[model samples]
Target: MWKIAVGFALFAGLALYILSKGGDIDMSGEKHGADATHSEAPATAVSAPAAAPAAPAASEAK
Candidate 1:
C-alpha cells in the first residue's frame, strides 16, 4: 500500500513538473482560437436583421 502511494505521488509530481516547464499550458480557460480575441458585436451588427415592433395583443371584453 505504501509503495503504491509513493509511486503515485512521484508520478504526479513528475507530471506536474514537466507541465510547468512546458510553455504551451493554458490555465486561463480562455479560447486560443484565431477569432477568439475579436469582438462579436461587429459581426452580429453586420449580419443581424432589424428588430420589428411587437404587435399589441387583442383584449377579450366580457
Candidate 2:
C-alpha cells in the first residue's frame, strides 16, 4: 500500500539524517586495495602471561 511506501521513506530519511550527524559516515560504497584500510589498526592479540607457582598452604594447629 502507499502507506507502507511513505513509512519506509520517512524511516530511511531519519536513518540518513542520524548517520549524517555522526562523526564518521562513509557512503562511498565498497573499496579495494589501499583504500580499504580502516582508520583504526586491528589490535594485536597479546598472549596471556604464565601463572607463577602457587604458595604452599600453612598447616593447622593440632
Best by lDDT: 2
lDDT, residue 53, model 1: 94
Q: How accurate is candidate 2 locally (lDDT)?
A: 0.90
Task: Estimate TM-scores for all models.
Answer: 0.42, 0.52
Candidate 1 Cα outliers beyond 4 Å, as residue runs? 27-62
Give the per-residue lDDT digits (tens) of candidate 1, residues 1-62: 99999999999999999998997765666786683675435644456788999776667433
Put down candidate 2 lDDT per residue, 1-62, tens digits, no spaces: 99999999999999988998897778899999999988987899999999999767666433
lDDT of each: 0.78, 0.90
Backbone clashes in model 2, listed as residue pairs: none
| Clash number by candidate, in order | 0, 0
